[model samples]
Target: MSNNPIPIVDFAPFLDGSAKQQTADQLLGSFKSYGFLYLTNFGISNEEVQEMFDLSKRFFALPHESKMLAPYPEARTHHRGYSFPGREKLPDAGDVAEMPLPSVKETFDIGREDDDSMLNVWPPDHILPGFKELCLAFYWKCHEVEKNILRALALGFGLEEEWLVRHHRMPDNNLRLQHYPSIPLESVLTKKVARISNHTDYASLTVLFQDNVGGLEAEDPNEPGRYLAVSPIPNSVVVNAADFLRRWSNDVIRSPMHGVRAPQDMVTEDGMLPDRYSIPYFCAADFSTVVDTIPGTWSADYPKKYEPMSVGKYMLKRLADGY
Candidate 1:
């Protein structure tokens, strides 16, 4: 209900190269400070955003049997397809044992159509006409925007513009459509369960589009246990640093710990919180790319903080942990 705690950064200037340096500075500053920022004019239109939300609702509304046609594979590295509610056990503050609840959400995941490293699972065309075409188009749209953001980040880090972009040329990203169903608020308030437990993402960066029924929160960097509300702003997308970037930056950038809970105003007279929807495009590098501290991020005074790992191996480990 209060004003959004995260800073807003316009991506138009970055696109036009008019105020690119200033924009890059602000983007990087927000990342280092809050690990999140609101992005506007990032090339995707409000109509397109709403369309995706509509598609997500339609997908989630399908019968359980119908939806299960494209089941989330058991293979640790196979992340595409539909996953039912309670399928994920998200960690709280990096510790899964501390959380008693399973994430009460269902998800539909998609990946690059041309990504030869892994194939995406999809419902039959008759099950959802035009679904694949539209989703694939939107996936690439997100890809283009994220590529530009990476370029700007490279500029902010004082590296060659192509330094970060080159590793991501394969577009091995994941597009996730998440739906949190209405549930009794008391369970969450009592800490017996949660819509989503606190945890940081595993991607290099995440571009999130959330609907106005807000419950999303970002942890306060200065106050360990405190969380600040990230209210939805019309037509704006939220961008955040994620774990891979944290490792790559050698702690120069932070991967924010965030989660969704029941929003006070949205709770009904019967004590059920309304369902919420979000579309997050998680950006990742090519599977074969070996991620280590970037050129300017380490030195004798602050040595490399993490061991080098290939994206494929890292993803497999993280995905295995989530379930």
Candidate 2:
């Protein structure tokens, strides 16, 4: 068996309109193979990425008492705020009730804007002016890019390019920020770091923009229990279809289960520091969109056995259970 490299798609091809058919064919190959692709030449600037990280560090630096304002389980919109470990359980595995507890990670969430209005949890103004605006601007930037990428995905699947984009629940989507700080050196001395156990994302699609630190790993199909590193490349967004998309595609594409490791896996580089910051945009369809089978893809298509649901309802269960 060949360990072929996953195709890296350049959005420029489509943007330039120089070779659309070729671009679409490449897109389709990526969709069918791993359902994940490295999207480069997409124009998301490095300075912009650095600014996003700098802001995240500032937020995380606020005293724990200050950061507590947006605590999880209490945030109604499930949008903003910091999440301590154990607050989100993994929903797709044996009931979240049965899954092992989550890791020691803190996250801040944001969402898309609509009608010039985007929902957010203010961190009491005098403390941080334009903080929300700065973060949200980055959120919106990723939001539009996500839609464009989805348009490419639809083309890859031989479906109308806008088919999935139109189906997305506007601005209700998530722009989640996470900080997997270097486990304290004392903890390393104590062997107490509790990293995120293995898991896959729950949204329809995820646009992950990670810095140079390389702890993210996916299960090696040929070597169970072992993991293959998802090394981050600068100036590119890591894209993957999620569980909802897998179901919607009738399992034609699967949600790849990935997890992180402790610092031992670290490969030192000039750009990487001990701190690992991640901001992923989870794009989803309206909760009401049913995950049904595609009719023309296979020889014997069967009915969708799953029940219909709105994305919010499903996410609530996942979060409450701890995803």
Candidate 3:
């Protein structure tokens, strides 16, 4: 809240050949600095964003039994469907032995329905008419935005503009709808539980649309132990580099740690909490795509820091560790 910590970038220039390079440079600077950026004029409209949020609210409002029709374990195989609150805990950077605090959030996950291996789970059409279609429409919109960003990122890294797009043809991207329910004041003040634990995303990039009730925070790039509030910006989407990108870039780009806290002003006079909603599109390359350090990202002094791994294997390992 102090001073919008993340830099804002206009994405419209990326479409024009004359201004494309400048836009790519700005994106590169933001990636190297905070690994987060607020993007506006990216083609997805404000009305579309609101529609997605409304649909998400409706989905979560369904009866618990109805929401659980697509439950975990079965849902875990394809990483789709509903996950109740308190089911996930993200451990800190070190000390895996230490138990992690359970996240105070419920999530519904969906992936590209076209992929047989990553088919999505949906409620009955009669239960929520047009829910699947609307959600998929939003998902593809976000994915389109993601593809354009990746092209700019490739330019940022001095690689072919199509370097990333070619490999990500059939990405294992996911659309996740997160709901952080309100909690009692006493529990919040004393327990210090966060809606989500501080953690880095496991994908190559993430495009997020969050409602006005802001609580997202990104770790300061220059100052450790300090964080910058990433409040929602009107007509913009928050995009961040993730672990895979950092690895692929040979650490030239960072995947900063981020978490969600309950908004202080969200508590009512009676201490009731407000429900917070966010939709994040997690983008990654194809499962069989082998990810190694990209060209021109490594030097003799700064050698390749990670071993090459298939995208699918690495993603599965990260998912298993967290879920």
* Top TM-score prediction, candidate number: 1
lDDT of 3 by residue, 1-323 (tens): 44776889998888766688889989989999999999999889899999999999998899999888867654334678889988887875423465687788899988888888776778777878999899888888888888899899889878789899987898679899989887875665554565776799997999999998888989998897787889988899999999988888889888999887656777889886688899999999888888888888888988888889799988888887776
lDDT tens per residue, model 1, 101-150: 68889999999887666788999999999899999999999999999999
lDDT of 2 at 225: 64
Q: Stretches of candidate 1 above 4 Å error?
A: 1-3, 94-100
TM-score of each candidate? 0.96, 0.83, 0.95
Distance from true location, Cα of 40 in model 1, Å: 0.7
Candidate 2 differs from the real structure by a C-alpha RMSD in angstroms, to one decimal, of: 4.3
For each candidate, the alpha-carbon lDDT, in order, equals 0.89, 0.67, 0.85
**Which order, best to worst by lDDT?**
1, 3, 2
Q: Higher TM-score: candidate 2 or 3?
A: 3
Model 3 segments beyond 4 Å from truth? 75-77, 92-98
- Pairs clashing in candidate 2? 88-322, 88-323, 89-322, 89-323, 90-322, 287-309, 287-310, 287-311, 288-310
